[model samples]
Target: MIDNEMSIEELEQDFWGEPSFSSYVVTTCHKARQKPIKDLSYEEIRCLIGQKIGLRFVLSVAIDILQANPLIDVIYYEGDLLLAVLRLDLDDWKYNQDELKTFISILQENRSKIENFEEVSNELVNKYLQIRL
Candidate 1:
C-alpha cells in the first residue's frame, strides 16, 4: 500500500516542480496595530497567531499545502515579522510548483491587511522570551 505520509523528497518533487531549494521561504509583516503588541506568553502568542491564521486565507493555504504534502514542514516566528518556512516535498515541488508559488504569493499580497497583528515583543522590556512550543 502507498503510504499516506509521503517523504520530504516526494513532496519537494510535487511542489517545486524541480529539485531546487530544499525549502521555500515565506516572510511577512503583521497587519497594522493600534498599539504595538508588547511582550506576551507563548500561549498568548499562539492565540494571536491562531487569530491571524483564521483571519488570513494565506494561513489556510499554507496549512493545506502542508497537509497535502507531509514532507513540507512549517516554522513560525513571533518576532518583528511573521515568518514561515516550508520544506517542500520533492514530488509536491515537481508536480505543483505553481500551486505552491500561488499559495505564498497570496500570503505576500495580503500581509498588509493584518489589523491587529504585531510582534510579541516590541520596544518594551519583555521578560518572556523562552516559550515551550
Candidate 2:
C-alpha cells in the first residue's frame, strides 16, 4: 500500500527507481504542452518513451493527482505507441482485448487530429469514459 503522505517525488523514487526520471518526465510533459506532439521528432518521442521510465513516471504522477482530484479522467501517451491510462481503480475497470484494439484503431485513424498529449487524453476521455469491463 502507498502512503497518502508521500510526495510525488518520493513516489517516483520508490515506484520508478529514480528521482531524476521524474524531472525528465515533467520536462517532457512541459514540452508536449508547449508544442504539437505531431511535430516532435521520432527521437524526441523515443526519449519521452525513455526505455519505459518516462511513461511509467507520467502514469504514476497522473495516478497520484487523479486519486486526489477525480475531475481528470485520463492520462495518455502518444508516441511510437499510443496508450490511454484511465484514471480509475484497476479493480473498477479494465479494457478487454477488443476494446484495446478499438482504441488503437481510433488512435491510428485520428493521428492528425491529436496534436499533443492533452488532445490524446481528451480523445480517450471523450470516447471511453463510459466504457467499462
Candidate 3:
C-alpha cells in the first residue's frame, strides 16, 4: 500500500529535473517537485498536481492532504485542491488502482467536509463520482 508518508522520490519521474515551463506557477511546481512530500505547502502541491506535473508522485501526498483537510486551497477559495484533483486524467490511475481507490475513498470519506462548502461545487464532485464509481 502506498501510504501518505511514502517518499515521492520513490516514484518514477517522467520529466527532466529542471523547470521546463517559464510561468510562475510552473516554477513553483518545479521547486515543489524537489522538496519531500511532507515539506510541501498546500499551494505547491496544488500547483504540481493541478498541472499534472509529477502527478504520480504527488498524488498520494495530495490525497493525504485532502483527507486531512478536504477544503485545502491555494490562490483560489476552499476546495480548490479537490477541484484540481477532480480534473486529472483517469488514465493516470491505470497502474495505481489501489491509490485511485484510496483517493475515491478519500472523496467519499471527505464528502461531509466539502458537501456544504460554498466555494466547492458539489455537482462537480458528484459528477466525478458518477464517472469514477
Candidate 4:
C-alpha cells in the first residue's frame, strides 16, 4: 500500500531504477487509452497493470490539485483497469468543457508524478513476485 506521505525520491528509487519499467508504463497507458481492451493480447496484462498503477497515481495528484485550486469538479474516476484501458461498457460521466480542459491540463502538468507512481507500483509488484517465488 502506498501512502500519500511517500516522497518522489522513494517512488523513483522503487520504480525508476530501471528504464524499461518507465517506458513500458507510459507506452501501455498511451496504447490502452486509445484502444479497446478486447482487442489487446493476453500477453499485455502486465501493461494493463502498469496503466492502472499510473492512472491511479495521476488521479490522486489530480484530486490534490483540485483541492488546492478548486478550479473544476471531478465527477467520476474510471477505476476499472480493463474498462479504462479498453474504454468499453462504462458509464459516461459528463464534464463541462472547462472542467475537462482543466482536468487534462492538470494531468499533463503532473506527468512525472504518474511515472513515479508507476515506479512505486512496479517495485511493489516485483517484491510480491520475489516473495511468491
Best model per TM-score = 3
Worst 10 residues of 1 by lDDT: 124-133
lDDT of 3 by residue, 11-45 (tens): 44434477767998868876776666677788888
Question: Residue-wise lDDT of candidate 2 within 31-61, one digit each (tens)?
Answer: 5433333344333344444434334233333
Q: What's the lDDT for residue 95 in model 2? A: 22
- State which candidate, 1 or 4, has the greater lDDT: 4
Tell me the spans in candidate 3 whose CA falls farther than 4 Å from its real position. Answer: 1-21, 131-133
Model 4: clashing residue pairs?
A: 15-119, 37-86
TM for every model, in the order presented, reads 0.23, 0.23, 0.73, 0.24
What shift in Å separates residue 67 of candidate 3 from its native position after superposition? Answer: 1.2
- lDDT ranking, high to low: 3, 2, 4, 1
Query: What overall lDDT goes with each candidate model?
Result: 0.31, 0.40, 0.72, 0.35
Better of 3 and 4 by TM-score: 3
Q: What lDDT score is found at residue 80 in candidate 2? A: 25
Best by lDDT: 3
**TM-score for candidate 2, residues paired by index:** 0.23
